[model samples]
Target chain A: MVDREKLYQAILTGDAKSARALTEEALKESVDPKELLDKTLIPAMDEVGRLFETNEYFVPELLISARAMKSALELIKPLLAEKGAEPAGRVAIGTVKGDLHDIGKNLVAAMLEGGGFEVVDLGVDVSPEAFVTAAKDKGASIIALSALLTTTMPAMKKVVAALEEAGIRERVKVMIGGAPITQRYADEIGADGYSDNASGAVALARSLAAKVPAAA
Target chain B: MPVSQPTIPRLEEFLFGHARCPVTCGNHLEIGAGTVIPEVNFTLQAIEICPENWADIREQYSLMIEDLCRRAVELEVPGILFEFETLPPMTVNPAWGLEITEILSETIDRFHQSHGLRAALRLTPNDTRDHRRPPRMRSGPFWEGMVEFLHKAPHAGADLLAIESTGGKEVSDEGLMNADLKKVVFALGVLAPRDMEYLWGEILSACEGTDTVPSGDTACGFANTAMVLADRNMLPKVFAAVIRVASVPRDLVAYRVGARGPSKDCAYEGPYLKALAGVPISMEGRTAACAHLSHVGNIAQAVCDCWSNESVQKVRLLSADAPTVSLEQLAYDCRLMNVAGQSREDARKLRDWLVESDSALDPQAYVLRPDVVLRIASEIAREPTPYLQTRRAARAALREINRAFEEGRLRIPDRERRWLERLAKEAEELPDREEDLIAECLPETSRETFLPEEYGLS
Candidate 1:
């Protein structure tokens, strides 16, 4: 039997070496890879994310744990894929046109991936047209728009309008997030949802994904 | 689903220019702490100083109007649009009002004389203000002042006048909507149908509420909000509105990237850098501008500290003292570092060469050399306390060297480990003076005052 508790501890402590070794050992012992991921890795990462959101852990700690989780996932990704695994949902994300800030978008992308979503990142200063194109091309169910400037907030509306113009407004749910974006703004823009933080974004994406016909 | 064609070409054109020449493109400006005033002759003076190389100039309304007038008189440059950011009252000391008007008038006078520049001013207001200060006043007084100043400019003056809406601290949708943007436009006294047409829509759109509010502190947040509101046509009247507020330009409007008030803790960097690099400014000026921001300076120093070569170290040391150091010594030091070979023998040869060629090897260089400087300072210093202080200073010096190394800004041998060992030894001895140093170096902020109970160091 594998010491799943120890594995969990390793993940929380960001002990990549120990976590990797223990996870591999568990696999060798006939432990299901999915069980190790679901019961041990994911839960540990979730706690890390919570600690991060609560300010109990700073960037350095979060980065280390994220790195550890990434390494561990690399080893498990193959097995998961071999079993015909799919992400929770597909998301197309970007900072709106004219605004070039990316940290918030990047954090949300990380969290979305962590939450089992395939994220197609359209880098900063992305236009409304780019967002629509990326969503349609990637077959994404959710479009996450981020803006950190009051000046660029209008670009978000333009992007929403572009989506409507492209006839994909109904096909994809639009979720907005950023330092300047708010629930009120989301409502004003007629966006599907708005979240203030990465954790909330993931949860929101997951909830919205469930409502999508294709995702469902 | 049909994929929409990207608007990248428009963005690139707006950003880079039709020719796509980086040097020919307009760049953003960092408006240092200054005042904008509306005056005629002053406006002409401003146009004379306007950097001809720049295409887009972001400034406050007062400055933008002045720049426009100046461009008109001096360069004959037409259609020179200026984005003016409106700031909250709290951010501006009322005492600086006159100064602001002075700067603005001078900028406009120059534009009027040149007949070369057309002008558009975007207003960005600061989102933070102390309620205790005074009741909120919209653009009325400012427009009146601007109109009085523009009346003095020559007829058929600079082309455009556009008002930009900005986010302010503690400003709510209701507060903005209640503020009379129309009255402000009336004060501008630019009753020409074209001017009125431009101003009314912007002001009204700015007055409309948006789902998103200002991020409370970041300039980018206010700028973003303004953009969103403008797009929704919720922004108050445009007869006074200068431009369609957008997040890209707003992120670039700041004295420094992360400075207090009117800057979002997030955003600004990516867009600003992209816009700046796309401009035609000289590399030296660009480097200086980049270093002017604390964040950029810190990153540069961090990179320098990580890797440094002897040549790099020499350049840094020389540059640090260039204002005070002799030119002959600077040249000699440069030559010494440029020489090949690294060993005790090489060091000795360099020392001999220095003695033979120059009166004395620059003491500062020797004082900064990882092995030699520490060894000498340690010998002269009486106790570990001074030694630690000296070590800290040396670390600061070496930090520059390290950055030069990593940036390939200079060429030097990799000696980070040896330097780290020295730093660690110095850190070990730091306990004796740690409290004193912290007291001297760490300034108190509102959040942490270094209370005795917090550190128990008392």
Candidate 2:
């Protein structure tokens, strides 16, 4: 039997090669893919998030660990799908129009993915219409918007309006985060949620996902 | 006398220099050599289409400036420095940008001539490369637009030139978020200074051609990013404080490349820049609440040469236009500092109050104290290279933070306490040579985000 402990350590330390090798080994030993994911990969990513919140691990660390977890996850994803497994949620994320800043948005997308969500990254300088289109097409339960500039922050409001116009406002939750974004701004813009940091964003997404109704 | 050309031969001269290095601008206004100048930074509520609405856009800015200058005259403020930080659309269209620049510069000139209330216009083009990954610093349309404006704005009557440049921000954004020291070093220490050296060379040539004062650059995109993140509890405050210290050497490159004093107001690291570079630094504190909230509300003003309200929109307020109200608040702040500076003892008293009020509230504010700034700056100046200076600044800040924590002057949660030790160890373990540090961090960096060749890395 494979030493499952090494897989957890590999993911924790962001050793993608070792994480991939170990996950593959665990599977060959007839280990359950769900068991490996629930017991090892998710726990490792959860700990990474915890360390991030505590300031022991920063974005670089979070990014590398997320990479490692994804590497192992890629190997297990097909098998999990064959077994009829489901992701925690589906999320659509993008940086709002006129703001080309993507580092923060990317971090949130990575964190949401690590938290077991199926994320559709919309890239930087995204328009409200594109976000609305993505929500409708991907059947995303949540739309994550980001903006770094005070000038571009208004675009976040335009997105909420677009969602309402698309008649998806009832089903799709909107969460916003960025340097200039505040809880007050989120409340004013009618966003369903706001998270100051990437780690908090994952928890916010999960809670919102729990409250969301199943896709029609 | 206001020096026609300002130059400092070495870093040692700036050790205790404050209000001793001045840059004369327009006809009569002198900043830093002595006395504080109030620089008002204002913007329209929103930018609309150009040519189609250039008339309205021009009128909006004209009214804001007219209101600001009238208030300056009424308040009996000695002088004003107006910074026109162009929004994206303005810079993208150089003709529209120059038209607005001409109007603002001509207006300030008119105000100075009529009221004898000396004023200078600082035109800061919004760095357009912000939208590009692996940024195109020396070439591309954004670069072309920026360079064209640099050459023409001075001729259009812009008296000073500066930028909140975003050269290394691609990696810097990632580094600050993850507490990644090596990435931070590369972004600020290596890439930023190199970009500053090149960009400021262009700025200096422009300044010489048009006789404009080459004002300094700010680590706004780099250090300020760390600060905003820390403020939101996304990163450790100590890391943010250390990043602020680390940014000094990077900002100093502007002076090395011939940028004269009175660096941008929003550069919160202005105090350390003033101490180490001996430049007149403009700083905004509580009054800048119009732009963003900050914890260093009082301490940021302790060593400033020019006081400022970062940027306020020209919207209606209960009492007056937002810019007018901001000017009143800033003018009062400058008046108090000027009155205090009339006597050495009185200045010290006020400086102490400014430091003590916010220093203990957060580590980010703590590092901005003049005494702390000098200590960290002295360590930075001793280093022979920008990379070493950046490393030394980070270590020195961590040292001060540790001492503060140990002495009970600052508080640290258990999580932050552990992080402080880890950061101190990490700072010490970083490669002693810049080459080795670069070699190690290169492979770790994502290639798609930035081009290593742009930074002269093979």
Model 1 regions lying over 4 Å from their true place:
B1-458
Best by TM-score: 2
Model 2 C-alpha lDDT per residue in residues B369-417, reported as the tens digit of each score = 7778767777787788888888888899999999998999987766567
**lDDT digits (tens) for residues B1-458 of candidate 1:** 00011111222122111111121101121111111111111111111112341122224334434433543334332122232222222123322322343344356445434443323222223222122112122244444333332222111121111222222212212112222222111111111112223333333333234211111112233322332332222332120011111122232222112111112222222222222212111111011221122112111111010100101001123333211122222223323322312243554344334323311121212222223222322222322222232333334334434343456543432322243344334433433444453453223211121122222223
Supply every candidate's count of residue pairs whose N, Cα or C atoms clash at under 3 angstroms. Answer: 121, 3
| CAPRI-style grade of the A/B interface in model 2 | acceptable
The TM-score between candidate 1 and the true structure equals 0.40
Mind giving the per-residue lDDT tens digits that candidate 1 earns over A2-62? 7888887787777888888888888889787787788888888788778766655443345
Model number with the top lDDT: 2
Q: Which stretches of candidate 2 lie over 4 Å from their true place?
A: A1-72, A84-86, A127-142, A154-175, A179-216, B1-18, B46-56
User: What is the TM-score (0 to 1) of candidate 2?
Assistant: 0.87
DockQ of all candidates, in order?
A: 0.01, 0.34
